[model samples]
Target: MPDGDVNAHRRIPRPAWDVINQLALRRCTDETHSVRFRRGSEITRWTLAELDQRAVNLARRLHATGVRVADRVGVLSTNRIEWVLLDLAVLKLGGVTVAVEPGRFEPERVIEKYGLRRLFAEGETSRDAVQDIDSVLSLTEPPGTDVPELPAFPGYDEADICQIKQTSGSTGTPRGIETTAVSVNSSISEVQELFRHGDGDNILVLLPLWFLQQRWWFYSALVFGHDVALSGYEDAVEMAQAVSPTVVMGVPRLYDDLRARIRASGAPVDLPERRETIQALLGGRIRYLWTGSAPATRATLEFFNDAEVPLYEGYGLNETCIVAKNHPGAFRLGSVGQVLPNKTIRFDRDGVLVIASHHPVNTRYTWCNPGDNQKVWLPTGEIKTYDLGHVDDDGFLWIHGRVDDVISPSAGPNVLLPPIETLLRGLPGVHECAVYGRAVRFLTAIVSPNPDLDPAVLSDRIVALNETLRPEQRVHAVIVAAEQFSVRNGLLNTQFKLKRRQIEERFARELELVYDKHNGDAAPPVPPVLVFG
Candidate 1:
């Protein structure tokens, strides 16, 4: 344990060796449902013993493939039991696991950066450059090991790097985050103490394994003796209903999808009953939900909570993994809640949140080599987070906008767009809205309103919103989206956050029209422009 740090309440023993060694010491009571996940069309369940043996067997296979200790291994796959199995196998062999986002497939960069020699690419087209993973799992695979006897678990030290996590690229290029066994294990222990998750808790994990929260849930589950049910976006609701998971972890987009479904189902008409039904649909035992990555709509938070399933928002980034969260003891509606135990937070000169973690964290980006310690951190170990926020007197953290996103309009006053867009989401017929500016004089908006809204009515609403803003900050004009921004379209990411640069480029012509109308001699047609700048 580090000096000046205390974990008086962390009951579950922090890893003496690594999590794998501790789990190896754990004795299953015949009631532990360690893992439950679906293969292509079949479901598989693994008990604690079975899960351990599989990792042990897989560890031998990994070693046979020439995976030396401290070697880097890449995994590019969707969420599945294999991802977990391979991760454990690599750790048991004292290797590093690097998660590469599937579909985007940037293996060359990851390989070059991390010096990776092997890659486990499941369900992917064989690239000529990397080793293909052979241990593709199926539902029919028997409980017993099919491989040779288990080798000595090339045990790892607490300081050995075990995982490399990539950011969501919310602001810029996704930076790879490195972590050691001590940090990862300590993190699981910290969260376990906060939530008190135990054997009775069945966690439904919907986000892909590449996501930070998804990996955190899995790590916490195996060590904490909880069961994890894995499912994709398409089957999450159905699986949740069947699994009856006690907790669910996901991004804000998931709740948005559910809220949309409930609206279509007319469930909110009866708040109490609707809450029960909805929670049941999401696996009735859901005590409270975990959400982060992006800002969740206030309407979504209030809707689920009003119905009984409290949606708790938290804050963290790729750099500082799980820094603060809103738990049952301390929760504020729009805030990301209080900083977690073993952490200290303060604001920088520009109101950017600076964080100091008592737990071990990677100090620099291995690939890019961010900067020297003095420049990257404060004297107290608080690292500067580009996220702009303020802590209230009550100790709750409230995010305002991205420091880089504080738009300075050459034509007028500064504008903060997140709040404006957040307000627009509450409007009657607006399904989604994205406000845009920068490299331009005034603000412009690209709105995706509910299809049922009357064009005339929506136009009026946009005009009404404009009246509330100043000349420089007001949305100069609105362009109603022909379709919802989607990940496939390159306008949105997997988290449902607008890819600002992509959206601006995609709507460059429309944006030009908005500014042209704002400053040009003639009005660039009404109604089509929606609202004038």
Candidate 2:
């Protein structure tokens, strides 16, 4: 354990570990209805004791296959009972579990980064890139065989590494973010303190457990001895009704989709019966909703407020494990809450956010690339967050956008593209917009105009709208015919964050022509320039 020196993040104490172990043991006994999930039309329930024993069995099997303490084992599957089982088993045996996001598998990179010795798949489709793995294990029964029996393993210490989560890799290549058992326990404790839960609480999980954020909720519930309800990829209304969870965690977009669906279906968004059901599940649960992984829009926040359900929003990254959250007594509708207890947050001269907390710091895992640390750190001890935001007078935090996207080249004053785009996207004719500056001189916008609007009218209206901006911030021209930004098109990342560099690279030729036209070079004699729209 690192000493609590000014230079080092403090380590977890022994008593915390003991408490976690005892909690896990007690919770294991209550597993009779600990987990409930649906397979087609069949509903399966498992007690906490059953889950514990299954994890022990899986741990023994994994150890027999040469897994050891600190070794990385990868699970590439969707959310299911087996996923949690394998995860707990790995943790119990002192092995680190790395969850592979569905549809975002990079086999070669996984092997190279994590040195995974064993890989588990839920189905054959998930084994598409299994060639790099040393051994592959199936969670379900093989074609003609029953599920393989796993052996039990000896006990594990609380200080052992539990999981190594890969960063979302929105900026560059991904790197393994190591999380120790003690840190996970601390995170779980923090959650239990803020969001009260008990054995009677029934929680619903919809976000992919592979995400570090969602995993916190899972462990928190488990630590609090709460029952967990799992659902397949179903519509929001079905999930809400079937799970009847008192507490739910979802991304901003998911909440938006749910609100839209509930409204469109004309279902009672906040029926008293459903509210009471949710409240009972959380042991008098006061709040039933939370949004993260991206900014929650004012419209989405107000939707829940109007429906009379308590929805709190928070902000964090894989590195810090949810440092700030909005609690029932400390929530502001649009803010991402205040800086959490025992954490310090500050801003640099350029307005980029920085965070320093008790969470473990990874000196070896380089997720952001060769110069990532330099980009996210200053000469001071704080870690550069890359996010741009400010704390309000009342201590609420408001994240504006990424500092990288808000560029100020020597040619002009600062230009914040994201905020501009946010406003533009809300305009009547605009569908989506990506604003970027090129060659340090001109500003350009790659826009996907609303399909329902007339193209000629939209183009003309957009041109007229640009006149409202200062000349430097004005759009040089609008690329109106471009397709909607998507991951498959190399325009969005796995987290649905826009890939600005990719979009710029894809539109290089058109940008060059635009630059030339502005610089007095002969303009290309073309109209309705497609530019691979």
Q: Estimated TM-score per prediction? A: 0.87, 0.77
Candidate 2 C-alpha lDDT tens digits along 1-533: 11123334544233233433543333365543477676567667776666666666666666665777667778777676777776776666556788877665656566566678766665443343342221322421222223344434343455455677877545556656666556566666666667777756677776667876565545655555777777643443465565566777666655555555444445454566445443443334434687777776676677666556777888887776676788876888888987766466777666777776554534335444776666554445456678888888988898888867777743768887766776555454455567866445656677755445465665565566567767566664556545666556767665556677787788778777766665342432222222325
Lowest summed lDDT over 10 consecutive residues: which window, candidate 2? Answer: 132-141
Q: Which pairs in model 2 have colliding backbones?
A: 31-47, 31-48, 32-47, 32-48, 376-384
Write the residue-wise lDDT of candidate 1 on 127-198 in tens digits: 643644554453214434544444555455666677887764444455676776666666666677678887
Candidate 2, overall lDDT? 0.62
True-structure RMSD, every candidate: 4.5, 6.3
Cα-based lDDT for every prediction? 0.71, 0.62
Candidate 2 Cα RMSD after full superposition onto the native fold (Å): 6.3
